[model samples]
Target: MTTTRKPGERAGLTPEIVFAAARELLAEVGIEAMSMRGVAKRLGVAPNALYAHVVSKQDLVDHLLDDVLSAVDTQVATQDPSSALQALMVDTYDVLLLHAALLPAFLVRQGARGDNARRLGDGVKTHLESASVPAERVDQAVHVLIIHTIGFAAFASHPNIDSNGYEQPPAVLRRDFTVGLKWLIFGMLDC
Candidate 1:
């Protein structure tokens, strides 16, 4: 038996494959199961083989989060800040719906290093500044928005972690979350 390559055959893998495998695994098993060994097993690679692509579990996690962030359509991030805020929230919540467990770890992480995190953070802030949000308050508002959106989804997804955790969400829960969001938007503060 022999393995062969045509001419320029790929390694049949990339950082993306590693990340996607991790994402799907995380969605299926929660963050606690996101070990490098697990990801390697899912990818059919030996544990040591993953080192060629990811430095450590943390590096793999950071890469996995980057893949998720890339999945979010951030057009709203470039639109006018007020509506952009709402739009960003909507999209963030959408991502949270599928990957809620990944939120706790990735939400506060700016990224691995210096400007990647700072740059991403600043670009988001620029929209707030562009919208004329009081310079002092934009950070606070972003914090609240992150909390509400992720917190809401985390609470929403909590029930699905049990052995028989695959039940449908109740209509009442849907109504309450929507109404709560509405109240937060219109009835609570005079933004």
Candidate 2:
């Protein structure tokens, strides 16, 4: 049986589906090798079909980055500013480590203007403000936190090419991140 999709007809394809496929493809081949055509091929659709949902490869990557950023747990589990900030930052670090493929995109986008990005920013800013971080230094603090989280995740995700036997396992890397995150939060909050 040979059923065919009409030209310009996407069948069941949706933006969500496209983004999902892109995420999977990125996870498999990384951002460098990921392409609109590659994503379309994965979905078994013509490459042109993706344009109906995404304008370009950059647009798709932007969406994917924002989509992943939405997963950051922003809830303040405790009223204590230091503890809340630590929790938020740890959650953010974990998310970045988990989706390391999007790290480059974050660097390019820089706290992307997407709604999810706005929400995450607002959440962090609220915590910082609550902690009485000086208004003049809040933005700088945010940038430092973003850089630290992304930078560390990128470093941790890189393959251990050291022939001199310097390798940190996942557990060690995670512990290091937690320790670093604690230092950043406490220093920023001065708590």
Candidate 3:
């Protein structure tokens, strides 16, 4: 006789479900405490069950990164290159801020081989090219924008700094980000 499948035993598990559960677990316990076992526990599944969808913790993090990056609005690439680039950076910063807990993991796993990452990179490259930024400087410009945005986001999300009274008000922070972005854009154009 064949045994009946339990109602909640892996029958409802999907990569999306796993990702959502993992994200919640990450937010709740942080990266150091986040693990397949924790995610499985959150989903009410055996730890081994998560491995069927995500081969390892790193793989799970990568998938979550992809999901987070996918929310970045790259459609601005069709507009003026300078504004498009700045918008992209701002959008990236917003996404990073929303997932601040995962930023450290994202930084450590630098090489994210995912479609969303590629799309963001491609949008930046296309915008730079459209702006007539010299071929030799496009890569450098892209690096500057990405690195600066990520660095700023990481810095902005530091709770200690905010608690220490070193944090700027929201308006001041936006102005500072815009000024820095304008400087980078102009520098690229002048090169």
Q: Please provide, for model 3 over 1-191, each residue's C-alpha lDDT reduced to its tens digit, 9 standing for 90 to 100.
A: 97765433345788888899999888888777899988988887788877768789988988988888999888883568888888998999888888888777666775345899889988999999999998898888888887777777766677433556675665666666778988998889777
**What would the per-residue lDDT of candidate 2 be over residues 104-167, giving only the tens digit for each residue?**
7676666455778778778888989998999999988888887777777777777653467877
Clashes counted in candidate 2 amount to: 0
Worst 10 residues of 1 by lDDT: 110-119
User: Tens-digit lDDT track for model 1 on 1-191?
Assistant: 88764211234667677778887787778666668889878988777767767778878777766555554555563455555655665666676667666775554563223333344355557666776667777677656555676667666666634356655464444455556665554422345
Distance from true location, Cα of 120 in model 2, Å: 1.3
Task: Give all TM-scores, in the order shown.
Answer: 0.66, 0.84, 0.84
Candidate 1: misplaced stretches above 4 Å?
1-12, 77-80, 101-124, 160-191
Indicate whether candidate 2 or candidate 3 has the larger TM-score: 3
Q: What is the lDDT of residue 126 in candidate 1?
A: 66
Off by over 4 Å in 3: 1-9, 159-166
Higher-scoring candidate on TM-score, 1 or 2:
2
lDDT of each prediction vs. the true structure? 0.62, 0.81, 0.81
* Model 2 stretches with alpha carbons more than 4 Å out: 1-9, 107-113, 159-164
Model 2 Cα RMSD, 1 decimal: 4.4
Maximum-TM-score candidate: 3
For model 1 the local lDDT of residue 144 reads: 58
